[model samples]
Target chain A: MDILESIKVALEGIWVNKLRSALTMLGIIIGVAAVIAVVTIGQGGRAAILSSLESMGTNLFVVYPSSRNATTPITRQDLITLEDVEAIKNIVPTVKAVAPTSYLSIMTQVGRQKEKTTIICTGQDYKSIRNLELVEGRYFTSEENNSRRRVAVINEELAKTYFSGESALGKQVYLMNTPFIVIGVVKNDPSNALGFGGDPPKEATIPFHTGETLFRNLRIQIEGQTYSKEEVQETIDQIVKLLHKRHRNEGKYRGYSLDQEVATANKILGIIALIIGSIAGISLLVGGIGVMNIMLVSVTERTREIGIRMALGARRRDILVQFLIEAVVICLVGGTIGTILGTGGALAVALIAKWPPLITPGTIFIAFFFSASIGIFFGIYPANKAAKLDPIEALRYE
Target chain B: MIKISNLTKVYRTGAISVTALKGINLEVAKGSMVAIMGPSGSGKSTMMNILGCLDRATSGSYIIDGVDVSTLQEKELAKIRNHKIGFVFQTFNLLPRLTALKNVELPMIYAGIPSKERRERALKALDKVGLADRIHHRPNELSGGQRQRVAIARALVNNPAIILADEPTGNLDTRSGEEIMDIFQQLNQEEGVTIIIVTHEREIADHTRRIVHFRDGVIIKDEEVLTPISARTTLAALPPAGEV
Candidate 1:
């Protein structure tokens, strides 16, 4: 029989038992759906990492004071200071700006609203280096930072939470009972999950001098952005050489950035996708078994019909083709439906998570063929069984 | 035309063997109407199976038309069966889901006939069976006699050398049975299509020109009927039934 003719017959058989065929195809549908959802999520995760890095700063890196031994995680001597930031600026031509940062956690009271928040102490260049966008008011000036002014710049979350929609500019909020006026409110950062660089800190920003005046024992963390990504190596080398000369502690400082964080995160996300995909693969295998079970039942149910065809001069190969085609048709139908539904679900999830879902044509094809091959792999045994039955006995079957 | 020599069929179950057809020899002339009659398990059905190429003989040669189909490979036997023989089973055996035209086109499909020609030929065959208006009806929608007629149309669609029927009228009423027999006789005498029927009823066997009687697994009597009964003339003498 012609392959098309056999396909026609197979379609008729599937149509005759609509509910059974649909139930049999359910496994493939869910299996393929999971695959598509995972791939789309993986693509979204990679994109999120890239965009998060870009939003934090342009061509940026962070310098950490590395501990030389296992016992001393952070010693008194292993701390980046303001001197290191100044030295790197004078040493490297590509150096844009360096913000020597220090963290201070304290309780703040604004009228009836009182909460604990961290305070960031950095230079006037912190505005440019960290790309801090102003939603209201303005950042502290060089004179205010030099003279140690008691002024502050709060983020959107801190301003909204403490101020309760009240105007934050010129308002006084006490940190550890020391009243400091709110100078500005910065825009909310959406990529806070990446940690320091992209996080919208619930804190105030004061000048380098005022921070020194407030805290006696200071441990500074210096971060800088460069002219471009290509100048990263030169900037790091110059900073390393400068720190070595200033403190005579060679290899004491380690370089990091949102870029490195992204690379690590992407590697982790790739593995995550694979793990989830493998779990989904198991579901697909189970679905294939369902197809096989249903096909075996169908073969047995149609044994007498097979005998009639055989007696009408159908070859064994013809019977094999018929059943195999039936199996494949079922899988393809389920695959097509699953692909559409999966893509839709991926888009919905991406929208909810505020991430862009990327679905390549190649991945779609891979998923489609994967399900089709599953049908073939599971279908062969039953088709072979149907083909091998003795026509005389089959005809005699009641 | 068929020629059989020392035909034998032994079925094995584990270590035990039972001979279904025991060393029987028979010959059937082309365009002749013949019947093989016996009780159940008398080997008449076994002989029909071998003749239809549904089973292979154990130690014998059976030639159909000009080819020695006994020595043919399984695939070759299938091809010969497709081209040289047609089958009609007792239960009507019409696929209940398919319309009469589609059922008739089945054998031609196996024979690789094109769709347009298959449709044309299937329609012609259904018309020959006097179900031209009911070509689109599924088997369940048709009566037992009409179902048998559909099966006959399916058999005739391929235009094979011989039509082999196993109790074709066994499931029908006497009038419907007579109608089925009438059609077979018309195909034999008018179209000169060789017909072989396997039946146990002596009256049904008497309608054919030749009857081969089987006792146990061997043929006991093979004789030509001097005057064969005419199913068409008998039906004509009775009251006219509704249009089939």
Candidate 2:
């Protein structure tokens, strides 16, 4: 029979028993919907994580002091110096900028507003080393850093807390009861990349020398160690060698690179994304099985129809094509509906919950192609069954 | 023309073998109306099925219009059924979902006729059966006589070499059955289409010009009926072989 007529007949068969056909399609619908929803969510999560990492500045490297003994804590002596930062830049061609940051937990009072936030002390190059957007005023100059002038750049949250609708730049804020002038107000960093999760921590930055003098007392049992800016490379080399020599008593500190740790963080995020995507892929498999099950039932129900077509001059290939077309139609319909629903769900979540839910064209293509292949893969047995039916016996069937 | 010699059909049901047609020998001339009359289990339906190329004989030499049909493959046999024979079952076998017109057009669709031409031919066949106005009526909407008439139109739509009816009137009333027989007689006389009816009723057999009696898978009698003058004139006016 002509393909159009066969399609008409198949459609009529489906329409004749609307409830059964709809119930059968439900399996496909659920399967497609599950696949779309899971994939969309997974993709959104991956984007969120990558974006969060990106906000930390792609060019910056984080260094942490390692110890062989878990109980041994890294102290102020283990802190990276400006000289070490310059040495890394000079020695490593790929190192564009280096900012050694030290954090102190302190109570800061802006007028009557008081909040506890992390105050990071770093060099004049810290602003350039990180992709920190300044919303007001300007970063502290190198001259101010050399003079050990007390100046700070407050984060958006801290600025709002201290200034309360007023611009915080050029205003005095007290850190640990020590007065400091705010030179700049940094823009709010994205809570997380891709907008999948909660907001990140609040922080502020100040000139390195100012931070050390205000937060540290010279009366402590430690010798004052000062290195010139030009000797930063030698200072970093000496620090590495000294640490290695001192830790020669232990094996854990060997072969450790701060840059390697940052790179490993990115790698971990990538692996997490892959694992999430793979977990979502399990739904596609279930959808394929659903197609197979429904197709098997359809073939059994249409046995006599297959027999009649064969007896009426249809070839085995014709029967195969007919049944395969029906299977594909079911999946294509389900896939299209699922794609729409998935995209809508993503958009809704993004809009209503203020979460970033990305729906990329690539994701749609993947979902569609995967669903179509599922149809073909599951349709084979049913098509073969229809094609291989004995015409005489089928005709004799009640 | 058709020829069958030493036809045997043995069906295996598990370990036991049942002979449906045993050494049957029969010949049917072109343009002749014939009936195969017998009681149930006399193998008349089996012979009809074999004649229509819907089944294969275990052993036989059966030729139709110079082609040996008994040795053809399943696909080739389907081709024969599509182009050389049309079947009318007692059940009507009208797909319940399709209209009368579509039912008649089905065979031509398998023959790969284009839609426009298939519709035209199907309408003409329905017109011949006097159900042209009911083309869009589904089988359930149609009366028993109208449904059987639609089947007749379907059987005639392909213009095959032979029309094979297996108890065509078995489901119809006496009046509807007579009406169907009249249409068959008209097709045989005016269209010069060869007709074969498998029936157990003598009244149904009496309408045909020839009868082939089967008993227990064998032909017991073959006899010719005397045709009326008008029927002879109608047959004479029909187009010759290959013209219709």
Candidate 2: which stretches are off by over 4 Å?
A: A1-57, A67-97, A104-116, A137-151, A161-166, A169-183, A190-196, A213-280, A343-366, B223-244
Q: Every model's DockQ, to 2 decimals?
A: 0.77, 0.43
* Cα lDDT tens digits for candidate 2, A1-398: 67887676566666776776576566666666666766666566555555665565433334445554435555555444555555555654444555656777778886677878788787766776556789999998878887889888888878876677998878998888878898898876653343334554467788777777777731111011112223333434444554445444322222323233345655776776677556556665776677678778878877776766665567777778777777776677778887887777767766675557888788889778877787788888888988888876776667
Name the top lDDT candidate: 1
Give per-model TM-scores.
0.94, 0.81
- Mind giving the per-residue lDDT tens digits that candidate 2 earns over B80-185? 9888888788878787778999889888878889889999999999999999899999999998889999988888887888998989999987667767887888
TM-score of chain A of 1: 0.92
List per-prediction Cα lDDT, in the order shown.
Answer: 0.86, 0.73
Error of 1 at A123 (Å): 1.7
Report the C-alpha lDDT of model 1 over B92-124, residue by residue, as the tens digit.
887888899999999998999999999999999
Error of 1 at B241 (Å): 5.0
Give a tens-digit lDDT track for model 1, residues A1-398: 88889999999999999999999999899988888888887787668766876787646777777765234465566577776777777877888888888878987888767878888888888888778799999999989988999999998889987887988999998876778999999875544655533435687888878989888877787778888877776687677667757776666777776567667877887887899889978888888999999999999999999988888889999999899988988988988888888888888988887887888898789888988898899999999999998898888878
